[model samples]
Target: MIRTHQGINTDDDLKPDLTPLLDIIFIVMVFLLLTASVKLQSLDVDLPQTDTRTLQTTQADPITINLMSQSPYWALQGAAVEDWETFKTKLVEAVKAEPEKPVVIGADKTGSVENMLKLLAFLQQNNIKATQLLMEEEK
Candidate 1:
C-alpha cells in the first residue's frame, strides 16, 4: 500500500509540476535568439559567390600583401619586405596615399599565425577596415 499526503492510499504517485521548468526554458530560448541576431563590427568583406559564374572584382586597384612561407619575409604591392620595420614603413606610406583602397592579404599555408595576426592588428589599428584574405583552391 502506498500512502500520499493526508493519509490517502491510491495507485498513483505525485507527479512534478513541469510548468515552471518549461517557462525557464522558453525565456532562455528567447534570450539566445535576440543575442544571436546581433552583427559584430569588424573587418567586413564580400565573400566570393560559389554558385556565380561571373567574375566580380569590387575594387579597381586593390593593394595586395603576400606573406611568404618563411618568417620575417613578405611582399607588399609586389616589392619584398625583409623586416617588420620596412613592412610597416611601406604599409603606412601606402595607406596615407590611398586611404580607401582595399587590402588583399595572401598568406601561404605554411606561414606563421603570429605574423599574420600582427599584420591584421596593425591594419585594424590604422583604421584600414576593408581587408580580404586570399585562400588557395584545393585540388
Candidate 2:
C-alpha cells in the first residue's frame, strides 16, 4: 500500500480519474458530429453531367481480325494480308467504309504473344479504342 504526502493510506487516491477520459470522448464525438453535419449539407458540386440523348449506337457490323497459325500476318475476315502495311490499309479501308465500327481480334492459341502485342500496338496507333477479343464459346 502507498501513502499520500500526508502519510495516510487511502482508497480514494487509488481511484481512476474518469472525468478527463469522458471529456475527451465527448469532444471527439462532437467533432465527428460536426464533420458529419457539414458533409450532409450539400455544397455546389460541379459533377460531370452525361447526356443520354446524345449517345448514338453504331449500325455497322464489327470487323474481325483473325491471327492464323498458317502465317504470322492477320487476316481481315477471310481475306489474306501479306504484311502489316497491307493489313493497316485494309483495316483503315474497312473503318472508312463503316465508321465507329468495333474490331474483334481472333487470336490463335498457337500464335506468339509478341505478334499479338504488335497487332494491338498497331491498332492503338491507328486510334482504334473499341476492340474485343474473340473466344470460343464453352458448350
Candidate 3:
C-alpha cells in the first residue's frame, strides 16, 4: 500500500518544471543554427562612373533620349520622334555624328518599360556601349 503524507504540501508536484522546456528550446536553436543556409542573389549592372579630371578633358554634351508616356513617346535631343522608323533613322545619324558623346536615357516616371527595353536593345544592336541614365531625385 502507498503511504499517505497528509502533512506535506502536494502543490510542489503540480508546479510545472522549466528545465526540460528550456533544454528543448536550446536544442531547437542549435539545430536551426547548424542547418540554416545563406545565399546571395545579384545582377550585373552597367553604370557610368565619371571622374572630375576626366570630365575636364571631354567637353562633349551627352545625347539625351527621352521616353515619354504619350503617343509620340520617343525624343532625341529634346525633339519628339514621329515613329519607330524615324526614331531609328535619327538615332543612327546622331550616334554616327557624335561617337564619343555618352547616350543618356531619360525615361519619364509614367512611361512604359517596353519602350525602355526597346531602346536598350537598339543601343546594343548599334554597339553603343557608352551610355548613361537620368532619374529624378527622390524627395
Best by lDDT: 3
The parts of candidate 2 lying over 4 Å away from their true place are 1-60, 137-139
Q: For candidate 2, list the clashing residue pairs, or say none.
A: none
Q: TM-score, each model? A: 0.56, 0.52, 0.56
| lDDT tens per residue, model 1, 1-139 | 7776888866555667789999999999998776554222222222223333443343546777777766545778767788998898898898789888777776766667788899889888888765566543332
- How many residue pairs clash in model 3? 0
- Any runs in candidate 3 off by more than 4 Å, and if so which? 1-60
User: What is the C-alpha lDDT profile of model 3 across 28-105, one tens digit per residue?
Assistant: 999877755432111122323433342221123667777887778888877888898899899899989988776767
Clashes of 2: 0
lDDT of 2 by residue, 1-139 (tens): 8878998989887899999999999999998766443111111212223333443322235676777665645678656687878888988888778766667666676666787898889878878765556544432
Write down the lDDT of every candidate, Cα atoms only.
Answer: 0.69, 0.65, 0.69
